[model samples]
Structures are given as C-alpha cells and as structure tokens.
Target: MSRKASGFTLIELMITVAIVAILAAVALPSYRSYVTRGRIPEATTALASKRVQMEQFYQDNRTYVDAPAGNNDTGTSTYFDFTAAPGGAETRTATGYVLSAVGKNGMTGFTFTVDQSNAKRTVVSGVPGWTDTTVNCWLTKQATSC
Candidate 1:
C-alpha cells in the first residue's frame, strides 16, 4: 500500500510563512498606531491633573509661575516625560501655563501640549493622520478637527 505525506510540504510551509509575513507587515503599523493612541491619555490625564493643581496653586498663591516644576507621572506612565512650563522662571508669575508631554523611550515622534485655555495640540509631523499644526482638538491618533 502507498502512504501519503503526513506533514505540510515545503511549498505549503513557504506559502504559510509568506502569508504570515504579509499579515504582520500590515498589522504592525496599525498595532503601533493603536499603542501610540493608547498612550495619549497618559499625557492628557497628567496634563489635566496638573492643570487642576496649578489652578489650586493660583487660588492660594495667585500665580502660575510658582507652582513647582517636575514630572507628575505618579509612577503610572513610562512613555512620556511630563512638564509644567514656565515653572519657577524668573517671571515669578505667569498669566497662563502650557503643559507638555514629550515622548520617551521607544515612544518617539509625538509631542502633546495643552494650555490654560484647554487648547490641546500635537506637534508631530509626518504622522499618518495627525496634523503638524496647533489644533484646538485633543491630540489623538485619529484625524479630527477641533
């Protein structure tokens, strides 16, 4: 009696590998974009919380300049470096503040900014759906208008 092959042939294995390669190539960028989008909230939340604290400081100190400058990560994020702008500058007081989160580690090509007016902006260029200009909309992975 003749027996047939019990395993995949070389041609079939090669085709499978090619299919996987193509799938990965297509999915990788989308996955990366999704991850980057997921990390955006870290910046937004940190900025929003800091904004509240700065407002409180203003309520007590009557200035946004003296509200201390530093990372306010709360040990929850590792992708971006947070900063409260105009922190303790010679001005001693600022009428407005700009909170920013610069991408760190492997999270490059993204910079998020928010001001006292709550105007959010993304300062990244060449991103698939992101604008390089300062927009009134929140910095998100999706292309949106403010």
Candidate 2:
C-alpha cells in the first residue's frame, strides 16, 4: 500500500515563501510611510511651538528679530534640522521671520515652514509612499491634507 507524506512538499514551502516575500514587499513600503508620517508631528509641533515663542518675542520687542536664546532649536528630534531660510542676507526682520524644518536621516526630502503670517507650508516630501501635495498646509500623512 502506498502511504501519503505527512509533511509539506518543496512546492508548498516555496509557495509559502513567495507569498511571504510578496506580502513583505507590499507591507514594508506602507509601514515605512507610516513611520515617516509619525515623525511629521515633530516638525509641526516644533514649528507651532516656535511660532508661540516668536509671538511672545514680538509682544515684548515689537518685532520678529532677535529671537530668544535657543528659541530656534528643535530639541532632541533626530528627524529634522531647523533653520531660518533666507532669500536676502536677513532671516529675522523687524517685520517678519521664516522658520524652516528640513528632514534628515530617514526623513529625507521633507521640508516645512511657517512664517510671520502664521502660514504653514510643506516645502517638499521625499517619503517613499507620500505625495508632497504642498496644499498650503502641513501634510501629516500620505495624500491627506492638514
């Protein structure tokens, strides 16, 4: 009498492996995007906090220049670099200031800004599964506008 094998065959194992590989290929990019989106809060919240500081500075000094010490810093966040971008020689002016948070490490291609008008902008996005959108607002997720 012929007996049936009790274990999975090589074809079955290969099929399972292929399925796992395909799932991983699809899931990894999505998971990466989710992680990147989580980091976006760091930038938005930091910019909002800085805006508050700038407002307080304006209230005290009547201008946007000479922000308080360490006011421009995005502390302890490894995903972004903060700066005052400039078209002219000046970044901070009596009339206004522009704060920028640029992506770093795993967050490359992402940049954001908030100016004196309280305008929030997404300058660019390099996230694996996200569109930059730049819809005159901060993008906290892929294709979703804020």
Per-residue CA lDDT of candidate 2, range 1-146, in tens? 99987999999999999999999999998888788889999988988887888889889989877776224455667998777765421678888888888888888888888888988888665555676557678888776566
The residue pairs found clashing in candidate 2 are: none
Which 10 consecutive positions of candidate 1 have the poorest summed lDDT?
84-93
**Judged by lDDT against the true structure, how good is candidate 1?**
0.70
Expressed as tens digits, the lDDT of each residue in 7-100 for candidate 1 is 9999999999999999999998888779878888887787778778877887887777767643344255698777654442343346777777
What ranges in model 1 sit over 4 Å off? 69-76, 86-94, 126-133, 144-146
Model 1: which residue pairs collide? none
Compared with the true structure, all predictions reach lDDT values of: 0.70, 0.78
Q: Count clashing residue pairs per candidate.
A: 0, 0
Q: Which residues of candidate 2, in runs, are more than 4 Å off?
A: 1-5, 69-75, 87-89, 144-146
Q: Largest lDDT belongs to which candidate?
A: 2
Q: How accurate locally is residue 93 in candidate 1, as Cα lDDT from 0 to 100?
A: 47
